[model samples]
Target: MPTPRPRPSRRRLLLQAGAAAAVQVVVRPAAAQEPPALATLVAQFAGPQKVREGRVKLEIAQMVDNGNVVPMRVTVESPMTEADHVTEIAVFNEKNPQRDVARFQLGPRSGKADVATRIRLATSQQLVALARMNDGTVWSDSVDVIVITAACLETTTSS
Candidate 1:
């Protein structure tokens, strides 16, 4: 019987191996790094606007049993007028990396300066609601949260 064709030549095998290694290097996912604090995230994303306290209202549970879907609401006392309406609202979580979770933009037609949504928190920490008005002023409010079972923590720690 004819001897099986010798395996691919050594040079071809080495070239194939090198190509595979290159592909692996290219396909690897970005490395995970520690997430910044809520205030730092806000500062980075908020630009140069002056962030003022107490103009926005943030509502979150004092104790959250589940971190996967924590309820949050934000309201700003604005008339929603053509000239004075809220332009944007952003949510930030203190314990989560990339804490700026969601942003909503509103106009005069929105009728109210309020928004509600569920967000994920990595652990027990503070949550912040920031609102930007049409006149270039930024308002914010924050509330501390206590998470009994954080989904991210559980998943990361394999507990």
Candidate 2:
């Protein structure tokens, strides 16, 4: 008569599963924990459309003493006619708790695709300005600003 094989212990199976789970945690290394990257935010805003680097211009100070109200202007080169015009302009920040800073909607009667305003910065990071045309084409421009004093502070509480 052939001898019956012994079944693997439940303890051994649990250890194997634990080891596999640990490996996954080590490989990912806080990717899910960390905030979304700037590119991800841009992708979410642009939706599947490709963003190009042209037409839109972002003008802001390269360096600022305070981030409370940093001035900026976004301008796009387009003919404000029913045939062609800028539909929207958006500003995004890399370090802010909210990726979206502002969004302005316009139409052919808007005359020009220019917007100037002040924004608060949490820290020194890149700012991206985007323009969406009536044809669904997207244009972008980015600038890096150094902030001496941060206007926003992010705090995390562990419960």
* Global lDDT of model 1: 0.79
- Candidate 2 residues lying further than 4 Å off, grouped into runs, are 1-36, 156-159
**Model 1 per-residue lDDT at 130:** 85
Model 1 residue 118 CA deviation in Å: 1.2
Q: What is the lDDT of residue 61 in candidate 2?
A: 91
Tell me the TM-score of model 2: 0.74
Per-residue alpha-carbon lDDT of candidate 2 for residues 26-58, written as tens digits (9 for 90 to 100):
665443332458888777778879999999999
**TM-score attained by model 1:** 0.70
Candidate 2 collision pairs: none
User: How far in Å is the alpha carbon of 49 misplaced in model 1?
Assistant: 2.3
Which portions of model 1 miss their true places by more than 4 Å?
1-36, 154-159
Q: Write the per-residue lDDT of candidate 1 for residues 38-106, one digit (tens) a residue.
A: 567777656798789877999888777788898888999999999889999998776676567789999
Q: Pick the candidate with the highest lDDT.
A: 2
